[model samples]
Target: MQPFWNFPATAGGTINSINNAGIETFRGNELDSLTREICQNSLDAVKDEEQPVIVEFKQFQISRNQFPQRDELVNAFNKCESTWKSKNTKIEQFVEQAKYILKNDQIPFLRISDFNTKGLEGARTGELGTPWSSLVREAGSSNKGDSSGGSFGIGKSAPFANSKLRTLFYSSYDITDYQSHIGVANIMSFEERPGFNTLGTGYFTDSHNSTAISNLLNLDPSFQRDETGTDIYVTAFEPKENWVEAIRNSVIYNFFITIWQDKLVVKIEDETISHENIGTLISKLDDDKEEYCQVKAYFKLLTSEEGIQVPYPAKRYKKIGEFKEGEATLYIMKGEDLNRRVLMTRKAGMRLFEQNRISGSISFTGILIIHGTHMNQVFKKMENPAHTEWEPNRYEEAPSEAKKAFSDLRKFIRETVQQQFQAETTETMDAFGVSDFLPDTTQVAGEGDEKKESLTMKIKSIAHKKKEKPKKKVKKKQQKENFEDTLEEVGITPEGDQAGHSNDDRNEGEGLGGGTGNQQGEQGPADEGTGGAKEGKGEKEKNKPIDVDTRYICLEKDSGLYRLNIKPEKKFEKGKLEFKVSGEQSDYILPVITVTSNDIEITSIDKNVVRFVNLTGKKPKNIQVQVDYEQYCVLEVDLYEI
Candidate 1:
């Protein structure tokens, strides 16, 4: 045998004194979160279950201590008859029933697409905390089907919270050959205060109702029977108002709609809400296909100017119809059902202010597909981020991956919003109706550099084209001379040149100098007589004027009659040109000096000289331009421009 080598492991004996640092206790909403975790487990376990799982919702009474309203009821119902007592006893019965159903039931109701079953093979159970009460969530696992977000039991809370009275469930599964058994569990909600905290531990518990139905079947020899399952029923649950069919639809739109695929089927009450089926949901992303992106937006309503400066940082409310602008309230939903899980639009549009309300906020939640590809920014103007709310979810502290994804997605969303509103606004303005309102903020705020560049280029082209001088008019006499030169070379001449013509006929092209020696000798007599002396001086001066290369460094202030300034350059020249001025650097230009009188004309001309008089009866503001260097200009602009 080989010799054994062992080293003692270090240990601390003060178990009671040492703090419990390694473990975190689940509490409050934590339990509900854990239920969600367990629901996932059950959904994964049903890979080969013989039958589909079923989900049911039912309501029972709550225990006096756990119920938020129990004490009030106990005081009122202290005295009662035998039958009344039997019917009303205490709230404990329901709590025990709910617990028993979760612990003992072999199969739990499973939710599978629109065709939910009583229960499926491999049932799982868990518990969670609600705002008002605690709930036990049960679900059946799936072996070969689409996954569910609600499988974690948090989904089950949706129906319970929204329901009014009763919920039900019925499930069946076969554990032995030719033997079938069916089980049923029901759920409901009750109000309770002083509930659990972040850790799942709480004094409040669920008010629930549960029962199991079992039997033996498979009588017909030709018939094939499969695995075991359970059933559930949610009765007396309140469906959302007229516009919304049910809470499930709202859930679909808010969270799960984006996952719609061939394999997943969703419904609103009895109405099928989504387009994609369960099969499509199960397929993995195609290698060549671009991944989906998450949408984020932070929004607020503004009635006052102050609101404009404060950035809104609030989450989307789960319930619809909570925002009231005036007499009407706006509702958000996907398709018809408001509760169904569905995808969010990149940019959402609404006639927000028309109905009297000023603004609203919305945020999107989903898994986004991203790659190394960089996203280009789209804004109303290259410099503006205020025009649109891009990332539906932006926070002060966020993960790097999330930050990058949101940055790209925000640009796309902002661009889309701008385009949509711009097109609509143009179409609308062209039509007959007048809109006495401001344009939607989302469309106008965010514009990127691309748009600004295109605009700048167009403006520059127009400016350049305008600067070109017009072409000079050519004379017919010059044309005729050129023509005669070509004709002589080709040995051809006009009839008038070859023969002879009357004075009237000859005068038609007289200035052309087509005649022979006598006329050629006198050709300059008419031009010389018209203006002989004036031409020589102009020709000499056009070639050279003394160049003045002085730069202006001066300031001006308004005066009663004329303007005053410290002139640092020569008087203006007719050929003076100004440099380009852009919005970004427009402030470089010095403040204009207002003219006080119309008589403001330079009475004296000298370097650093300015003198004028108010000839007009009424004095007007005098105006003058001041010149400064780049450093001076930068210092003069308003604080906001920086």
Candidate 2:
């Protein structure tokens, strides 16, 4: 049968207008929304298991005559305008603009075509769960796989939002050789004739059942979905000036993992984002924003051959919520200018959100790739409509499990961050003193002899003018060494604030690769096919002293000596180095027998503090610290200003 525009009669039902909350959900972000949603849906519709699905976005202008039934749509717009001319401003304004856009002799269309996937099937039986019906005949509904990137089904509205005329055309040729096509217009309620009103939602199909056209509808010459896939034609496309770059960034931002894993490839205009060019694309995103930087970091983690794999049944926590089941890999790297948040992403490779539950005061970036069937099934339920955040309450199946899972995820993130970097600078100063962690110089015998040449010299250095930014507060109770608040009061701020900076130069991605060679394999063995044990809420978390980036610590064999090699990031004047020894279940100050430095001029050696002068940034300064204990145990050192 021939096709025509169909807006079913309301038949004295509740009147509707142009205020579509689903369409409005993507306001001001039409292009980004479209890119994210369209790509996510394609990822879910994967047909071949071994190959990647490809999505191509091509926009071109065609003469208005090329689009069939153009006059009929224009007539509908006229009726819509006349019916709500002065009755509703929003409807009136929308109709006026849509009518104006329709009057152009040359109409613009953005034809998005996808390949290497099953097309919109199930149209033959007109079934409810078919791809054709789910995408065309239905709204706010979906039947994707367990690990699909999308869940809310609201993503379908984003395409309409990109169209100035609020119209969209969907056509597909399924793997079964079945073909079907349909068009939908979301305008306002209007009167087709006297005393007869039609629905605001209109479809280009048979009036009786809204069945799609069985034959393929060629809307544009530049597009032809000859393969088993779907094509979305966004009419009256009003793309932004930087729409190309924006779309490129959005594709990478949302599906970097899929692209990097050879599961998805996106072609925009002349640029292709696949496993081959994925690295280069990620590099270009270095200057975009924090979110983009996160994308760059995530891409680096996914491509890198190293990271920690935390497997199912996370059984470490006692008080904190623990994961009873899941599959995930975590990669954390400490460096300059890292935003210090965990990138939580699903198997679909789309980033659900950046987690900042409790990062503590350590500068690092973490990526948690939650994959596998059981994990994705649980995690996807908590995802919001936009696939941006994890909303535990959104889980209708089991709210409690989802909430606990979310909490456990945060705990795991926080604990891993704390374990990787000694986030706790020192013990609570209220209960301890600096002298408690340091040895008494009067009790040592060599103190009287080294005092002859010790002369206190005042060090001169450049005074910084910028105000220091305070570190974030995190409450954690892991027992360890008691270094007190010395570093907290006089710690080095070598390079001013690092926020709003670039990390592309750090090459921080080196040690972050997972499932390969690493010096940290000896930490603790983990479940098969996963990373090792991370210390948190245990002994590993204790004795975590702040590590000075420019300093290195080592203990000599058959000697009571701990050598500290210091090379400041920026120049420093005069400072004191504190050395402490490991205590059973707790840490106390190791009594210093003697303090000596090769290049530094020692002003005085009091207890554990080695006050020195002229510690230049020109070269490394070697300081040999002598203690009474000969046996080697875990040791920690910190640098403080005099």
Candidate 1 TM-score over all chains jointly: 0.25
Q: What are the clashing pairs of model 2?
A: 305-513, 305-514, 306-513, 306-514, 307-513, 307-514, 309-531, 437-589, 480-543
lDDT of 1 by residue, 1-642 (tens): 111111111132211110111111222222232222222323333334343322212223222232222233232212112113344334235334433333332312222221322233322222123201112222322122222222122333333332222122223342322222221112211222222111111111121222122333221223233544322333222233432222232223232323232222234334443434322322322323322111111111111122112111222222211211121111222111111111222111110011110111112111111111111111101211111133323322333434454443334433322232222323333534444453433433478544432223334443335555434322222222233354466553222111111221221111111111111111111011111112334521111111222122113212211112111122222211111112252211232222222434433221111223323323222334332223222111100000
lDDT of 1 at 623: 35
- Can you give the TM-score per candidate against the true fold? 0.25, 0.65
The lDDT for every candidate, in the order shown, is 0.24, 0.69
**Candidate 2 RMSD to the real structure:** 19.6
Top candidate by TM-score: 2
Q: Which sections of candidate 2 miss by over 4 Å?
A: 286-288, 312-326, 423-642
TM-score of 2: 0.65
In candidate 1, position 368 carries an lDDT of 18
